[model samples]
Each structure stands twice: as structure tokens, then as C-alpha cells.
Target chain A: MATLKVLVTGEDHAQGPEDADVTLVEYGDYECPHCGRAYPIVKQVQKHFGKRLRFVFRNFPLSEMHPHAEAAAEVAEFAGAQGKFWEMHDRLFENQERLGEALFLDLDKELKLSATAMRQALAQKTFEARVRADFTGGVRSGVNGTPTFFINGQRHNGSFDFDALVSAIQQVMITAKSA
Target chain B: MAQSGASKVTPIHSDRILPAGAGAPNFTLHATPDQTLTLSDLLGRPVILAFYPADWSPVCGDQMALYNEILPEFQKFGAELLGVSVDGAWCHAAFAESRHLHFPLLADFEPKGAVAQQYGAYRDADGFCDRALFVIDKKGIIAWSYCSPVAVNPGADGILEALEDLPK
Candidate 1:
């Protein structure tokens, strides 16, 4: 029984309603190709479920393998501080192949973020600890790799493809309805 | 938790682990085709013996790759990682190179699960080790152990936590 050691809390970055019927948490790496492939699928699942779903994203960067991952995570956390987490998060996945300093700066401009503040934040390593905390939380939650999902505080031990994810979420919905 | 999707066919993890404070069983196994590594030689530093089923299996590969990526973290606690499998030295060598693994993978092949059996990790029903992990202290005392489901990659957090808990 490999379960999530850490349950989702308010301190976490989350979307949808807190009282949603189903919760979907993803431990993802910004630079992972598999996670990039999963981006659209997760979006589709969100659209399908609508108000029935709550979404949370946590960082679990494999920095050694993905050199750009740590920086990208920090950038997302920075945007999160400015109330623009989802904006940066969506752009990161949308432009997974173009991950770098240049991309972060470009995103800062497009998102109407203060370029000077963003530069100082990166220079001072701000949000590094926050991103690292998210990573540590993921590790404690039994996240072995990127794009690991949890449904209702339990590890979703399945292929994260669109169909599999949909079926798993629907199962939760059915159980909730029956209960 | 919910055992849906990839976990439908996966077996549950049970209390099949070797308990902590027990003396770690020793062995000599081929690390490279021409090189042999003995357990006793690594008694001074904490050792992590990860006995997995075989090379190239999806779960095992993911587990090893994750360990490989986190090798430095294990090293920070002055710990050494060794992957043990029932595969031959040549197979281990190829797998190590293909995955760019930084740790030595000992072959438990000659006697086929001999070392794994001694560690109570061998799964006779499946003819392989049941994806077990053992963290041994400097004095060769087992500090902690876990038996993960064959289909899952039981990441390195437990091992790291065990290392951090080692009496200083």
C-alpha cells in the first residue's frame, strides 16, 4: 500500500473549488517530455469534469537529468507570488521545448509581470526554497517520477493517458455518488 | 488507497521486509565482468542494497533511473547505493551503461537469487527479487527496509529518511 504520505493542504497551489467532488493533484517536472505530453490530456480532463474537479500542481524536478527544470520551477513559483501561477504554468507546458532564461523573460513580458522584479527574484534565488518545498512534498507523497497524479489524496497508480485518467476520475465520481 | 489503472494487476506490499537491527547478510558478487565486490568491503559507510527483479523491466528501470538521478543526495549522507538483480554481469553492465547509472549493480546470478534469498527479498513464486530495499548502517546493521510492489517504483525518500535518522 504505497499511499500519499502528505495530503493536499491549503498551502499548496491549487485550482477549482475547495469543495469540488474530486481532487486531482499532479507531481510534475517542468522539463519532462512525458509531462509535456500529458499537459493537454490534463486540460481535457479538467474541461470534461468542470466543477466536479479540483486541480493541484506540485514541482518534482529531476534537475540532474533536466538541467532547466529547477530554474523553470523557480520561475513558476515566482509567478505564483504575483498571483500568476497558472499563467506561468500553462506557458511552461505550452512551450516545453523552449525552456530557458530567454523563455522566462519572454513570459514575464507577456504576462505583464515586472521585468525588473522578475530579474531580481531570479538573481537572488527567490522562490527556490518554495519550489524545493513542493519537490520535498512530492517525494514524501511517493512520487517516483514526473507527472504522478493523485485522486482524492490517494496515489493514482495508473497510466496518466487521457482515457485512463478519465476512467479513474469517473470511478471516483461513481464511488462518491454511491457513498 | 485506490488501486486503479496501472495498479490493478500489481500485488500489494506486505511485511515481508527484513527487520531493522538485524545483521545484514554478506556476499561477494560480480560487479563487472572481471571485477567482484564483497559486502564486507563496504562496512564502514552506510550501504543501500536495492534488490530489484531484473533489468529492463519498466518499473525496475524507472526505479533505478530515479535512484541514479538522486545519487548525489544519497552521497550527501555518506551513503553508497548498490543495485542487486539476478541478472548476469554482462546484462548488468549493459543495463548500467544504457541507463547511465552511477552505482554498481551486483549480479546475484551464479547461485540465482542466493543473496536476495539471504536478505529475505527473493520471490520464489516470481523467480526474482520482489523489489526490496535495505539501508544498512556503518556497522552492517540493517537500519530500515521496504518491499515495494513489483509494478511500482518505491522512490528514494525512505532510504534518505533512514540515512538521516542514523545515530550520529
Candidate 2:
């Protein structure tokens, strides 16, 4: 089994308590259709687990296959720089169907981010390196595709649906508690 | 399900693929509708030949797309990656275009798996190329080769490891 090569650090975008029983790391692309489908399921999982689960997301954009993925990641990173990472992250997936310069600009307005700064950031690719670091980290961690999950540092090979993910996390929670 | 005695005695053909240290087989295959790529022509630089089953089917877990994403990593090793299948040039052209692939996807379609047969990567029963990967050195010698189960996508880690092991 492939284990996570890069551990979660202060640089990571995380939610929930740091002392949570389980940590779920997802290497996801913003424009991947499968990841789009998984978006709500993950939300459901997060809701189901609540304070017991910690979630982290990393960018693993397949730029060739999904043209807007890298830019979307950059946008999220830009939002992250301004402390609105989760809001931008959720909005990107929530509006995955219309991902482009126009959609990004609209998101900037809706999220109340600076239009000028966002435009300059996108034009200059200011957040590209940050997005690329996450991508490269995913690659080294045996991530060949988007929405790859690593539960508690071990790669999750099972389905990403609600029931499957819940059961997998439950099993991990049990093991963690026992240990 | 219980197997019959006849089925138990049936011999499976595990044809040996060209192993490491063997001289790589030279073949010219259609990289596009008009252009042909020969294995020997890329003698000075390392080459990676990936023989997958088909074009449209995600049987190999979108292996071509995975390779397409990591083309830069392969480039860092100064290696050229080529995807081969029995699909026609037109089909490959469409697939490559749709996937935005940077590497050339050679078509072994004219004679139908002729190059794959030479490399022992052809699936005789299925009428398509098996999911196989071959890393050839700068001197046209097989440095490493792997044949994964048809349902599995043998990721690029092995290829990268092999490239790292090659003489610099």
C-alpha cells in the first residue's frame, strides 16, 4: 500500500480539531468530474464525523486533462493567502461546471475578495508555486489521479462514496481508540 | 465455483517479455497520420514505451492521462515516453487531442500489434496490447520492463526508479 510521503504541516489547509481521532487527506483537482461528484460526499462524510475527523486538501491538478484545474488551485491558494481558503475551496467545487476566468472573477466578487488583487494574482500566477508544491507532493505520494484519499497517512484504495468512506473512517477510528 | 479437471490442466501462456540487458527491438510505428517514429532513432536518449490495451476504455485506470500529467517529470530524466496500442492513427489522434497529451502515442495498428509482439507485450487472446512498460537506456538496451495485470494501471514509479538507476 502507498503511504503518504508528505505529512500534514502548518502549510496545509486543514479543518476541524488538530486532536481529532482521524485525519483525512485528499489529493484533489478542482476541475476533475470525479472529484466534483465526490465533493458533496466528502461534505457528508465531514458532517457525519464532525469533531472526530480532521480534513486536509491538497492540489493534484491534471492540467492537461483539466485545463482550469491549475488555475482553480491557484485561486484557492490566493484565497488561502487572505484567510478565506475554505470558502473559496467550497465555492470552486460548488461551481465546478463553470470554471474559467469569468467564473473566477465572479467568485472573487461574490467572496468579497479584492478584484484588482485577484486579477493581478491570476495574471502574474503568484500562487502557482504553492499549487505546484502540493501537486508535486501528491505525485511523490503515489497519487496518479485526482481525489486520492489518504486516511491517517495510509492510502485509501476503496470507494469514496459516503457509506464506504464512513465505514473506512470508522474502522480507523476504532483502531486509533484501541491503540 | 469448482473448476473441472480439464480446466485445471490447461496451460497458461506466460510469454517472457524482453528482460533487462537485452537489446531493445527496433520498430517504426505511426506516431501520427503522416509521421513515423522509430525506436532506433531515439538511441542517444532514454525512451519509455508504454503499450496499453485500448483508447477509450478506462481499463488501465486512465493510465495515458496519468502519463500525460507527469510528462514533465519524465522530461527531467531526459526520456521520451511513447504510448502504443492497436488503435488506428485517427483514433489515437482523437484520443491524444482530447487528453491534451504532450508525448507521441505510436499506433501499432497497420500490422496490428506487430511491434508489441516483437517486445512480447502483445495479448494474443485479447487482440490488443497488454498493459506493459519498457524503459530503454541511451544505448538501446532494455533497462527495465514490466507487464501489469490488464485491469491494473502500473504507475510511473517503476519507470522513474528505473530512469534514476540508469547511468548518468
Candidate 3:
């Protein structure tokens, strides 16, 4: 169906080493229910693999479908500029049901980010371009829906449950080792 | 999966679609109760023909939903995206509204699957169109075609790539 347009690159918001053996990229929407469910599972995936895995997240908000999706993605990208993207990412998914201006303001205090700066960023729409770039990349990459995961450079056509993801990653790990 | 109440008809669209570089067959289909669209009317612009089995089938739902999301990309290439199925105009209207789709879904009803049969995408046994795609260039020639498994979503990557390759 959809193929990854550009592979994991220096511009991505990534966790783990730059040269990790396995690179897992998730094209996600914070306001999407399925992505919220995937949040904890992705955390477990990272914990299980540790140093062997590199995880990257890209914004892919379906703005027309989810009214709050674009705003949530803007907040995440703004937090990324302040060096707390992962924290904001987790908080957004964890507090998915309450995504709005007030929640973002509250998160600014909780995450020790600058409230004035966050407010201005949202008001001025500073990171809209950044979020849109990620979204455009996701669209080109064959991301048909929220929480579409790419293992290596290939699209994973199976389910994203724990066992399915783990086995898929292990298969990649094996392929890498043999090569 | 085949939709419930679909008739058991003989398979006629089992053959592959018209190959790339071939002249695309022409047909007109109803896009809405009051609107009709013809292949010839879309000659100057690129056309993405998305042929799915039925309106409400699960995989077709996902496929169309995804298309609804990236419609701007198709428009960016000066392309017309049309969803084709044997489902009637009323069924398409309901489905498009429920999904908030922004594109025209042509009804290949009346003589069901007539257009799909011209493109070799009709499935006689299933009594619906197969999940297929064809990207036609400005000259009304087939630029790309793909027949995906009936159960899969068949995302827009191939369609986008084909559109990108068309002459400016």
C-alpha cells in the first residue's frame, strides 16, 4: 500500500542511538484513539529492546477527522523544540481524552516548559510548518492511518500488537545479523 | 469479504486491467443523483481510478478513508480521484457522508460493473469490482495499474508515484 517516503533521517525526533541496529519509526496522531492505545505498547517495545532499538515518531494528524489533532501535534512539535518531545508525546497520549488549549497550558507547567513561549507558539502557529512537514512525509510514506509503523524502511503489513511487533523486530534483527 | 446480499454472478473481470501505455477505455458513470462523469471529460488532467468491490466492505472502507485524507496530494498533481464500485449513487452518498469523503464516487450500477468490465476489474463470481487502481495520464493512456488482494487497503503510494511520473 503506502511505502516509507524518506527513511529515518537526522531531522527526526528519535530516541536511542543514531546507529542502533533496528530503527522503528511511527507515524502517529496524538488525538487518535488507536495511537493512544499504541503509546504504552510502544513504551514496552522500547523497554524490551533497549539499546538495540531506535524509535522515531512523526506527526500525522488527520485534521479534518480529528478537530484537536492539529493542535496536539503543534504542542508536541513545540515541546520538541524545548527538548521534551518524548515527555509531551507520552503525556498527550496518556491524556488523550482531554486534548485542548488548557491541557497544553497545564502540561507546560508540569513539564517545566515556558508557559509564555508555549502560549505564543500556539497563538502564532510557529510549529505548524514543522508539524505539516512531518504529516506530508507520512502521507508520502504510505501511512494510511494513525500509528502506522515502519520497521527498517519497509511497511509492516501485520498488526501492531506486542507479539506482532516484537516478532517483526526480531526478524529484522536476525536479518541484520546474518547480513 | 463479499458483502451480504451480493448476487452470485459469473466472473467476468478476471483478466488483468489494460496495461500501462494502452489507450484507456472510455465510459460515463453517475457520480451523484444529478451528476454524471465521463472518461473523455477528464482527458487533460491525470485520473486515479480506484475500483473497490462495494461501498461498505471493511477493506474498501479503510482504502477510501485513506484516500479521503490525502486528496489534496492528488489535487496537487492536477489529478482527479474517482472511486468506482457497482454500488448505486444512494449507497455512495451515504458512505461518502458517513466518512466525510471529498471526492466523487462513481456508481457503476444500472448495468452493474459495466465500466469495471471495460477496465477488466469486475469480479463476476463476487458480483463486485476487484480492489484495483489505474492511473491514467493526460493523454487518456494508462500510466499505472495495480490489482491488490481483496482484503487489503491498497494505500495511495502507488497512485501518487504514478501521478508524479506523468509529464508536466
**Best to worst by lDDT, what's the order?**
1, 2, 3
Q: Please, what are the lDDT tens digits per residue for candidate 1 over residues B56-102?
A: 87678778878887787789889999999999999999999988888
Pairs with backbone N, CA or C atoms under 3 Å apart (clashes), candidate 3: A2-A142, A3-A141, B11-B124
Q: Which clashing pairs does model 2 show?
A: none
Q: What is the TM-score of chain B alone in each candidate?
A: 0.93, 0.90, 0.90
Measured against the true two-chain complex, the DockQ scores of the candidates, in the order shown, are 0.40, 0.24, 0.30
Docking class of 3: acceptable
Candidate 1 - CAPRI tier?
acceptable
Per-residue CA lDDT of candidate 2, range A1-179, in tens?
56788999888999989989999999899999889988899899999999999999999888887889999999999999999999999999999999998999899998899989988998999999888888777777777576788899887766788888899899999998999
User: What local distance difference test score does each model get?
Assistant: 0.86, 0.86, 0.85
How much does candidate 2 score in TM-score?
0.88
Candidate 1: clashing pairs of residues: A158-B6
Question: Which structure among the candidates has the greatest TM-score?
Answer: 3
Binned by DockQ into CAPRI classes (incorrect, acceptable, medium, high), candidate 2 is acceptable
Residue-pair clash count for candidate 1: 1
Chain B of candidate 1 vs. true chain B, TM? 0.93
lDDT for model 2:
0.86
Off by over 4 Å in 3: A1-3, B1-15
